[model samples]
Target: MLQKFGFTQYESQVYEAIFAQDQPLDATSIVNYSNVPKAKIYEVLNRLIDKGTVLTTMHGKKKLYMAVDLQSIILKIRADFEKDIEELKTYKIKRTFTDEHIWTLKDASSIASNIEQLIEEADSSILFLAWNEQMDKYRELLEQKEAEGVHVEVLAVGGLQSSLTHKYSLIPMIEDSKLEPSQLIIVDYAYLLFAGIEHDSWKAIKTTSKPIVKALTDYFYHDVALTQITKKYGDQLLQDEEIARLLARLIY
Candidate 1:
């Protein structure tokens, strides 16, 4: 069990003996009992004492040694381990929520390639909203998926009127709406991609988590009515949506 926590052999033996003993024993007694060298016993005892696994007392002219509160030591170790595990879980949650994987691309070609990879890996469906400029690169991939009988729903803004004439199905949102240059694609509720475009910078983030992806998908679905009306009338009707009405009812 000690080895499982990366304890060395000598350390494990010394600790085990100390833990098993009913009372503390001097180095000589420990040497006799443990069959470790007398010279090595002092070193081991000192280390154990420093680790709070043993204690020392004065016995007449010489110092007597004893194992410290073994139960307390074990409890402390268990509590520390539990704390460490909790911290690790919290860090994992933060990493998943932040979508820790990031990629920086310098040009449109790289961006197109990355988006294509996301599409190819998608297993269920693709949910996309973007501007007309970026659509050209994804157009062939989208059409290919449609040819393969995969469902694709795109919400595009600006100048899709002419391009909307094609056989491929498309959904139009408000014209010149803030194009979601920030791309998000969730696949099979298991994988996710979030891409962003700034004035001169571009980045993509990826993650895979069933629970988180499902939660995000559910949140979107839960607010679908609000999302549709918001897209239709822009942010000006913030006070008129069903969600707003519910909040108002609660507040009043």
Candidate 2:
């Protein structure tokens, strides 16, 4: 135990022997109690005395040694550690930017969980474009947002929420949207989540890029406009050269 305070093996044994004694121990007694070689007892005792852990007193021609308070030494070491902890805190600062880059979201359950978190955390608007499955999955969450006075807009087939929100069902894409099934959700114009169907599984990507948010909202608006155009012009929109080009490229 004394070795932890920088005492060597023989010095530690001698110090422990002195600590065990209620009265001081002379070099001969220290070597016998410590089980150390008699030739080495004076050398170890001298080192312990120099290190301030053991004090010596002259008894006739003999020197006797006793240990200092172990509790006081331990308390001093603890105070030094506490001082180091405070100094380390001076260099630690709160980070404003963290990992907001694009991240792969795996599995259907994980996708749903992240979408739920986005809805739960949104401070402003929500822009969503999805198919039947996602609409069924997150319907209650959307209703809760609406109840909280969040501006929620959804574009999907089976226009079930058009009455409660600024919702628009899909206006038939020029290239049929039924071929590839997917979901797109943007919240607060700061975060986006995309879930696309691939065979039996789903692949998703989440990001906090403002440019991506802007682009998605813009594309969603174009579809919203197209829905109005389809209502007004019907088949005649597919005939217009410019609208047809837009429909060809914009497959929402």
- How much is 153 displaced in model 1, in angstroms? 2.0
Expressed as tens digits, the lDDT of each residue in 76-109 for candidate 1 is 7888899998776435211236443444565656
Candidate that scores best on TM-score: 2
How many steric overlaps does candidate 1 have?
A: 2
TM-score of each predicted structure versus truth: 0.40, 0.55
State each model's C-alpha RMSD to the native: 17.8, 13.4
Q: How many clashes show up per model?
A: 2, 0
lDDT by residue (32-129, candidate 2, tens digit) is 89999998887887787776778888889987788888886577557766898877644434336744588897799999888887877776888888
Measured with C-alpha atoms, the lDDT of residue 124 in candidate 1 is 58
